[model samples]
Target: MRMYEIVLDGELTSDLPATAGPVGRRQEGGSTVLSVPAAGRDALEEVLGLLESLGIGITAMSEVEAPA
Candidate 1:
């Protein structure tokens, strides 16, 4: 699995439950960050698309080292 960090433009506490592959979540400054552990590229893209459809502007998306 791969871990992805998706940073959005604003808070998204209410929208998280509907996320495709969120493993964790938290607020970073003015944005809501979602930690998504995807099985592959297809799954990751699905999650990103879902979030984008909600009108939340994605500020950043990057692959990160998974937790130990």
Candidate 2:
């Protein structure tokens, strides 16, 4: 599994998935963090497509190693 951190200018959906969807939550100093996870290539592409369709610009992403 891999995790991707995406930053956008606006808000996102709440019913996101834990494996391959966006999760919005409040952070330090009232900032919001939107995170998503991808298990493989197909999952990652699906996430990108979703973001593109929503017109939500993705700022940055980091690949994280998932624990077994």
TM-score, structure 1 vs. true:
0.75
**Model 2 per-residue lDDT tens digits across residues 2-62:** 6666565555545445555444343433333454565556666776676687777765567
Clashes of each: 0, 0
C-alpha positional error of residue 25 in candidate 2 after TM-score superposition, expressed in Å: 6.7
| Candidate 2 off by > 4 Å | 16-34, 65-68
Worst lDDT 10-window in candidate 2: 23-32
Instruction: For residues 1-68, write the lDDT of model 1, one tens digit per residue.
Output: 56888888888877554435445778999888887775566657877777778777989988888778
Candidate number of the best lDDT: 1
* CA lDDT for candidate 2: 0.57
